[model samples]
Target: MGCGRPFDEVIAIAPLQRCHVMLSWCYLLLSATMTIECLDLSECQAALGMESGAIAAQDILASSSFDEASVGPQYARIRTDVAGGAWCPSTQIDQTRYEYLQVNLHRVHVITCVETQGRHGGGHGKEYPTFYMLEYWRPGRTEWQRYKGHHQNVLLKANFDTNTAVKITLDTPIVASKVRFVPFSEHLRTTCMRVELYGCEHKEGLLAYSMPSGEFYAGHLFDDRSYDGSRNSSGFLTGGLGQLMDGRTGGEFALGNGIVSDAANAEQWVGWTKPLVEFYFLFDDIRNFTALSLHVMDSSNSIKEAAVSFSLDGRHFSHTLVEYFRYENSSVAPGPDWLSIRIPKQCGRFVLVNIRNTGKLLLISEVRFESGDAYDVEIVTDGPFVGRISSPSFEYVWLITGLLGCCFLCALLVTIIAIRQRQRKVTSPSYTGLKSTPQAEHIAVDLKTGQMKVIRDTELWLPFLNAKANSTNVYMFDSDKCAVSKILEAPANVSSVQPAESASTTPLIPLKSSSSEEDSHCLSRKELFFENMRSEYDNPSLHYAASDVRIVPLSKAER
Candidate 1:
């Protein structure tokens, strides 16, 4: 059944052969299999729903004389919010042959696809681009490149049906910082269109590199204390990275503490002593970076002017690569702002930050460099770092709680050990051994220092005299091994006697009764009494006699 075949060839094919060929083709078509796969529609939607980096755009202007009350109100409809009404710029009387819309993306992106929606109003008079072309501008380029298709075709068509949304998918993604849409439509008077850009916010092939170490310096003088590498106080001064990158725009001046330039002599005042300062960043590896950010202090008098440059080698730098950013002091109500410098993508290992002090004081709070996949380049500085969040985190609270608990546990253990030691001292048996010598004269002994003490109390001295007088009967000793006197019971006629000087050298002797019969009887009684007292001293049954004090013979030193 081939077309343009000769008549003779067609006639030669038999009816049976043609039928077989048709059956074979039908079988082949029926036997074909396709692989089906599920797609994450939400993920796709999320990618398409990214916020457009477009800060400003052409073709969004409206003439003040137009019927519309305000100009550029329609520009709001082109943002990420789809619920907002469409952007319908009133063409009014003036119209151009080739109307175009140009968008400044602010930063580079890899554009994958773009979608366009017509006005919500339904009518045959609806306006949209019948034919169009997409173009984009790269960094450092003055010219635009025409977006191409998979087959290298530079032209594209969109919105053939008015009032209907159309999506154009590019065969190949383009890396660009700005994009433009040119509409060549017959409906030029109706210059209204809603467009959305869908793309990866970063280039596909680039790898995200970690932040690098950084140091601060004043001109040629390096300050070792200026090195800082932390989340909160990433700047050479104070504050953190989160606040610096909060995207707050600025125009007025306020005062606060942050990174301030210091002279080699710490006593020298900043700005006056050191009019200029610079920060140096060292990358672990060379990187192709495109943007750098600086967050100045909240004062107009702080960080008035700055410049950034890159170099493969730190010492030698190319003048052509230098970018200057200046703040005009003459401006009314000028304040601190986050300034981002977009540079042509280039590979380098070092970034030099230079600042000129226009105000009486110079201070900068934060610095961030945009490198691989737009990851922030890290800076290392000598710092007393602070946390990024003003409020404490759960982990910090938990850590502190744990430390306190540990301290309490340690203190409890120490207290328990001390209490147990005291209990042992109170419960355990205590015994003390003291040495003494029986003397005819009275004396006292110091128990603590093991020294002989003079008897100042007459009762103590009289006990020894009573013991010597009563020596004629029997000797008696108290629990402390000191002599006890029964002087009140002694007869009044019995004279109190004093030992002679020889008594110092003589051993004390027990006195006996003079009458033999009476003495024998008295001696028998006394011996019986002594035997009973001796049994009492050695008795294990005497529970209260297990005293902590004891007496033994005096040592040579005590004697």
Candidate 2:
């Protein structure tokens, strides 16, 4: 028998070179002849040990510069290989935290899946650990943030036989120029075989979706979740407290053709050529307002610019030029359009708006009015001030002034008349004394052929004695005290004596008595004298005497 060699000595084979294939086969035959069991380390120890050394070596190699002599040969000799055993480490994997890949994400899409080949025990035991995790970072960002890979719950099993795929969605839909992926767990450490991205070239009038469709809801003016007052519907084309065309009441505007489409049918055409509805607003007080904004939607259910106009008076409108926007414009259409007009001051009562078509569609589900500071400072200040002045207060002022003026004028006229009456009373003529005890003084004269008689009663004539008379034929006496002493021959036409005083007093006296036939003759004589006085005083063409005899007083003796 051949002498048996020690196990350590037999297993201590020399490292093989390029020509060691034949030597390795001879060594295996010698080990089989020894009749010993071929034992291997547990899977956990095997994987951990292999990965530790490989990871360290790879870190060093990856840190080295890619000089032509060193990395050139390695890169050319790189080969594709499948993982073996429970775990396999990727030779080309990058472990740098800041590393990223630049890609043209224009119309591009990428999908990823993860699968576990086998389970590793807990704390080095043979058990699968719950190790589902994901992380991502953008180009400009420095550190990766945690992210949910998909809506589905993550599942782990002790003995995983099938693959589990996790889908990730981009937070923003963008044409990304670059992207970075950070793995959450070591199980997904395999090298990325390929990346797929999907998108379309920029086009005009291309619609991503219909705004009026059920997928897109309208936005609200005040409430973040609601459009208008309705929670179930989408937002309107315009918004505000006075959004309605005819004041506070709102009107109807069609949003789209009432059709729905999906991503498969994207890039479709949908839009409104004309305004479906218009509104007119009149701000009674321009001071209360500050800014105006509109929320609109496109065929893609995106907001777009809507034409707007404002006015001081309702008749004349000034188109407001839009300056700012909240969404990005697509090459296919004119804008990511929404209209917002800032008012620097209040526009008194008249704000007129015309909602021209949103570039994409005609459907206007809702509108909103956001209160703002007035744009026009002058209008804000002057409008209310001028209106108040023209209101009831101004009218009241005018009325009060008018009434005061009338009262003043009436008072002035009364004052003037009173003054004139006082002056006349002060300058009026006066009369003076008569005999103290005398009762009556009487006189008579013959009455033949119209001779006149004179009787005096001093008491009766006292009041008129001082009055001036112009004619000598006139005489005065008091009828209450004077009496005729004798009866003179009656005139030919004289009638019976008529009472001097009667109960039925009359201002005019007849010259003729009723008792005599010749009374008409007496009347004729009296009429002649009356006519003479009338001719002197009543004629427009003649100048009358300064002092007439009828206005003068006569002495009692002449009576």
Best by TM-score: 1
How many clashing residue pairs, candidate 1? 18
Model 1, 183-255: lDDT tens per residue? 5554335544567676654422221111222233344222112211122233233111111221222223322
lDDT of each: 0.40, 0.27
Instruction: Determine which window of 10 residues in candidate 1 has minimal summed lDDT.
Output: 238-247
Candidate 2 has an lDDT of 0.27
Using Cα atoms with residue i matched to residue i, what is each candidate's TM-score against the true structure?
Answer: 0.28, 0.21
How does candidate 1 score on lDDT? 0.40
In terms of TM-score, how similar is model 2 to the real structure?
0.21
What candidate 2 gets wrong by more than 4 Å, as runs, is: 1-274, 277-287, 295-333, 342-353, 358-533, 539-559
RMSD of each: 28.2, 34.6
What local lDDT score does residue 232 receive in model 1, on the 0 to 100 scale? Answer: 26
